[model samples]
Target: MCGIAGYIDYTGKAGDTELKKMTDALSYRGPDASGQEVFSLNNATLGLGHRRLSIIDLSPLGKQPMFTPDRSLSIIFNGEIYNYREIREELSAKGHAFISGSDTEVILHAYQQWGDECVKKFTGMFAFAIFDEEKQELFLSRDRAGVKPLYYYQHNGCFLFASELKAFFTYPGFEKAIDPQAFRLYVQYTFVPAPYTIFKHTWKLEPGCSMRVDLKSGNIAQQRYWDVLDYYGQPKQKIGDAEAKEALRQRLIKACEYRMVSDVPVGMFLSGGYDSSLVTALLQSGRSEKIKTFTIGFTDAKYNEAQHAAKVAAHLGTDHHELYCSFDDAKAIIPELPECYDEPFADSSAIPTMLVSRFARKQVTVALSADGGDELFAGYERHAALLGIAAKKDKIPAALRPLAATVLRNTPKTVLNKIFSGNTSADNLAKYLDFLQGKTDLADMIDFANQTAAPDTLAGLFTQAASPGVLFRKNEIRKLPGRLDQLLAFDYLSYLPGDILTKVDRATMHISLEGREPLLDHSLIEWIATLPDEMKYRNGVSKYLLRQIVHDYLPREIMERPKMGFSIPLVNWFRSDLRPLFDEHLSEKSLAAHGLLDHKQVAKLLHEYYSGDNYRFTLLWTLLMFQLWYKKWMQ
Candidate 1:
């Protein structure tokens, strides 16, 4: 894994100075070594810079801007190619020779032999840019799940790209103007969605995509190399439940086995959740030596999961390490979030993820995260709630459904909250009603369910129109019959990559730690996506089949417990340990200076929180995160 930065200056004004700064800014992402290169041709300059973490080959030969023997193609890559050894053996048989035992060299040869087709053959997370000197082109590609991030900024004919958004700020001419639409979107979604960044001209390259930029003509061609829908859109599983379970077990073992390839020490982030527990079980089953496991806990009982993690670790006989953080330790990390994320991100779980990554980094260079399991296998409470609402909504006539939805939307949020105080079903009702306003369907409902701020809330903040979320723009889940499939597909396409993966990537990368997700292996995802929805969730239980598989290695008593997320006590902290930050960030002066939020609405949110309706935490955190980011970047 590494960090890459580069620029293609159409006017030849770009040089090594800016390239050095861009690459240097990302040194935290790759603390092992660094390199920079520049080429001038056709009144244009092409520069590539890399910060190497040195996972595969520890020697100097693994240094990048890696190139083929002829030096016609050079690549700056960030991520592991888990199947590189297999690909290397294939290349060697085809008369291709490699100089070092490195995945970077394998990628260079793969590109040399197969051209753009090389990306389709890769099975691991990656975001890379390759410069083809002979063709005078720059090829960029992100892995299928967007496990890695690639951000780019284009203005005045200068194109710059980096692994993190902050690298763009290193360019002297780069503008700091915020994209207003994207800003409002960030407030609503808690993270800027793909194809849009905080800045107008900057963009996030979507997952499973590749682009070829003609250096001479400056024409860019972009396309998707793979799609999860291609597999999920197929008919449901024809095999029996037992067969599906066995198939899943084998695929997971293979994925974990391949991800274990590295020259550095590796470990697992064992949250004691179904996903992480399963990963740990598979990893420990075959090995004689214990694998390292790390978990982060809180002093407060409600927010801590370390006990469960410890129990799981003891049962598995692994080397478990944990840190129970005080509220002050978490609060101390708050000020650095603006720099740590380099974008507006408000997922509260990032706190624990950050602490856990730091804890693991002390012992291991690479750690596996169980991120995609929830989205793949219907593991969230919201999924079950949405399905239940869909069933009831199906009973309503299509003609009258819109009117009923309008009535629900017209109801005051405060009135609903008052009547259903702390009732999860009522919250689901509100979400379903909000979803019903515009489009009364499974796909539209899925989009509405993920919002942190409603349209009325956004309108009160922004001067211009805040367009509806881009999620329901099209029905990509045509073959997904029930609510579960549609919700899964939406979360996979939107939430998983946009918010969840983004949170994990930023947190882990900030500490120069590599995080792998075995559960997210495309092979396993495709296999699970094709299975029946009941296999994933049944009898009011999420991940039912997953639980059965996990039971083989763990006792039923240990595996059966209420689902607890790696979440922090945000509302309590906001009112206590972080009260000063909350007051300062949302004070009238701060609100007035920011000018993107309505003072009255902000006051109302504050009232709700102080009056014991702590449910406003999500919206409050969303505003605080956006406000913090605005001052740090836009100002």
Candidate 2:
């Protein structure tokens, strides 16, 4: 992976100093090397710069702002193409000569052979900008699932594109206004979705899409090349347990093998969970080399998974490294959050993710992650709960439905939490779902926002529930095998790419390390979508098929342990080491200065939580992240 930045100075010539500043700002993304290329078509108006991470080919020949043989196309790219070698061989037979062993060169040749259709031929994550010298157009594309990020700004017929939003600040004319609508969405969703960033003029290129800007006409066009909705209408197929398990095994092995193509050393973030263990086990089965693995443990035993990671590393006989994180480490990293995310991101797991990536980067340049497992398989507890709730709601008699809804509304949240804490899977699922559904009045939560955002903000909750993929149409007579399958599909479209992938991408890229997710392989995801839901979740267990496949390579003890997610001791930290810093950053005066929040309401949340009247850790964290982000980017 690498960092790419450039600008189309349609109003004037982009000088050397401007290009240097843009490229220099992104040096962390590609510490290996850097390159720049300027074109003076239409009176010296377009320039592109790239920072190289040097993963595929360490040779100088692979360095970019690489050009086609005919010199008609010049490109800057960030990401890896797992199928580059296969595509290169095909192009060579067709008389395309290659001067380097890098995937960037393969993309240059592929664009030459297929034109804009080249994106369809690619099967990896990427975000690239290609300047067509002859056509006088700048073409930009992001990968199918947005594994790579591309941010851009357009003002007065000039467009600047880069790997991170911070790069846009290099230009003197860039403004720092916060986009109010984006802030509203961020508060509702905990993330600002694509096509919208925190800044008003800046935007992220949506995944599986492309854009082209014509210099002559000063016009831009955006279009979608792929989407999950395309596959939504297809009929679900059934497979026996034995057949499904074997198919998943083969697909995962192939996915891992494809991602293993790299000139530099490759290791994994082995958290000792089912997801990472499965990837590590597959890599160990085929390779003769000692696979290097890294994990981070917290001082709090309840939050640490390092011991489990070490056990898996020992079983596989691979080189292993472990880092223990303390409350001080979490405090130290808090100040760096604004710079790392470049926007308001409330996922506190980003701290551990960054720690593991930094530790792994010390040992290897590329790291494999098992990120897509929960979304692809029926893993998260929410999926099972949503299914059960839908089933129960459907069975309620029409006459009593309104009364039941009223009763659910009147049920105190604390009482519901108590009722849902039993050992039974169904009870646990119900409790979690009830909490998420936030069945209680929004008046309480609304008071937590800066000010009560518009009532429309709560509409997002309904939109998520009634989203196109989440709920089937009432009249449609489709027979899905179970609720688990539906939940898996929903998460694959939303949570996986939106939250989990975003967390890993930002963390790893911050350290200039390339992190690849093999479990998110498109072929494997599509195949798994066809399997019966029971093959995924059986007897209240998650990742059932994955555990079975892992059993073939490692002992059952390692595969069957209790599930432990990558989490930090936030509740403890809030009451201790982070308290002072948190208070300073989220002071009521600081928030009121932004003029976006109600200081009184914000104070109530902080006061109630600190006094032990409520445990509003997640909500408070989200508010703290936004406050820090505002201080960095807006104020």
Candidate 3:
């Protein structure tokens, strides 16, 4: 894993010092080594820079800006091709020669042989840039699932790209004002989605897509190269229970085995959950050498999974490490949030992710995580409960629907809170939607300065749900399983990428440790997508099939335990240790100084929450994150 940044100066006047500054901003991502390459072609310069973390081949031969044997194509890559060895053998048999035993070399050779179609054969997470020297064209692509990020800025015939938004800021002519549409979406979704960033001129490349920029004409074209729907639409086949179990076992083992092909020592992040435990078990089962496992614990038992992780590690006979996080630790990291996330991000779990990655980096160079399990296998409690409530709502008489909604609307907040008990359901859909509105309604959220281009986040969500062609399989699948599958699929498409992956990437890269996700392997995801919903969630249980598969290698006691997420005691912290900071940062004066939020509304929320009239901790934290981010990046 590494960081890549570069520019194609169509104006033909940019200097190497500019490229150096861009690469220098990403130093935290690749502390092992750095390199830059420049080529002058057709009165323009193509500058490429790379920061290497040195995972696969820890030698100078593996340094990037790697070129084909003829040096016709040059490339800089930022992710691992887990199946590169297999691809390398096939290419070698087909008469391709390689100079190094590195996945970067495989990509360079594969691109030379297959052109843009080479992306179809790749089976790992990657975001890369390849320059076709003869054609004077730049080809940029992101992985199928967007496990990594790539941001680019195009202005005045100059195209600059980087692994992080911070790199773009290093350019002398780059602008820094926040994009209003992006800020509105950040308030609503808690993170800016693809094709939009906090900066007006910058955009994120969508997953499964590639972009090509022509130097002479300054024309940019982007096209989707892969679709998850193609795999989902295949005819279903039934396998016996034994056969299914064995197939799952083989796929997981292969996934783990492939990720273990690193030069440095590797470890697993064991959260004591079924997903992480399964990964730990499989890695132990296949290897003779001891594997290291890491976990973070909180003093509050409700938030602590270290004991469980320790138990699993002991059972698996691995070298285990645990770190106890206190309020001080959380406080120490809060000020560094803006540096970790280049844009305004509000996921609090980022704290634990960073702490764990910091702990893991001390013991291992590479670490594996089980991040995509929940989204792929229906592992969230919300999915099952939403389905059940929607089913019950469907059965209610049409004449009673309005009456029921009226009653729910008139019901006292206290009574409704008691009845639903914090579960977001159709019965309380209006309130939940209100909560998600985040400070303002859709119409009011748009900036007056750019009324012609009012932000349409809700429209974007519907467009995503109703996307045309093969990608619409998610919309079709939603029709089959009540509205819950739609919610889950939306989470898979949006939250999994926007929040979870962002949290992991920043945390792991900040410590210069490469983190890989075996469960997120695209093949396994495609296979799970084809399975019947019943196999995923049976009898109100989430991830039923996954639990059964895990039981094969772990005790029932460990498999049956309740899920404990990597969470902090935000409620307690707000009420105690973080109270002063929260008040100071979210005060009316602070909100007014920011000028993006309405001070009156902010004061109302603070008063209501502190006076025990409302539970608005989540909203407050979102505001706090935005405030801090603005202070760090904009001001």
Which candidate number maximizes TM-score? 1
Rank ordering of all candidates by TM-score, starting from the highest? 1, 3, 2
lDDT of all predictions:
0.85, 0.76, 0.78
RMSD of each: 2.6, 5.1, 5.4
Off by over 4 Å in 2: 412-415, 418-486, 613-615
Clashing residue pairs, candidate 2? 450-597, 450-598, 451-598
Better of 1 and 2 by TM-score: 1
Runs of candidate 3 with Cα error greater than 4 angstroms are 412-421, 424-485, 613-615
Candidate 2 residue lDDT tens string, 179-284: 7777765765567767777787888888788999998887889998976544534556666778878888888888899998998989998999888988999998
| TM-score per candidate, chains pooled | 0.95, 0.90, 0.91
State which candidate, 2 or 3, has the greater lDDT.
Answer: 3
lDDT of 3 by residue, 1-635 (tens): 99999998867677789899999899988998999998887867889999999988898999978988788999999999988988999999999998898999999889888989999889888999999988888999999888889999988667899999899888876788766667666665667877778788889998889999887777899998976655555555576557766787889889898899888989999999999999899999966788899999999999999999998898889899999999899889988999989898888899999999999999898999999888877776555545554455556675676667667667777776564445422323453333233332221211111111122312321111222122213345444332434554556666677878888998899889888999888888788776666677777788877888788788998667777778898866777678887789888787766566666666766776677533456567777898887788777
- Cα displacement (angstroms), candidate 1, residue 385, comes to 0.4
Roughly what TM-score does model 1 have, to 2 decimal places? 0.95
TM accuracy, model 2: 0.90
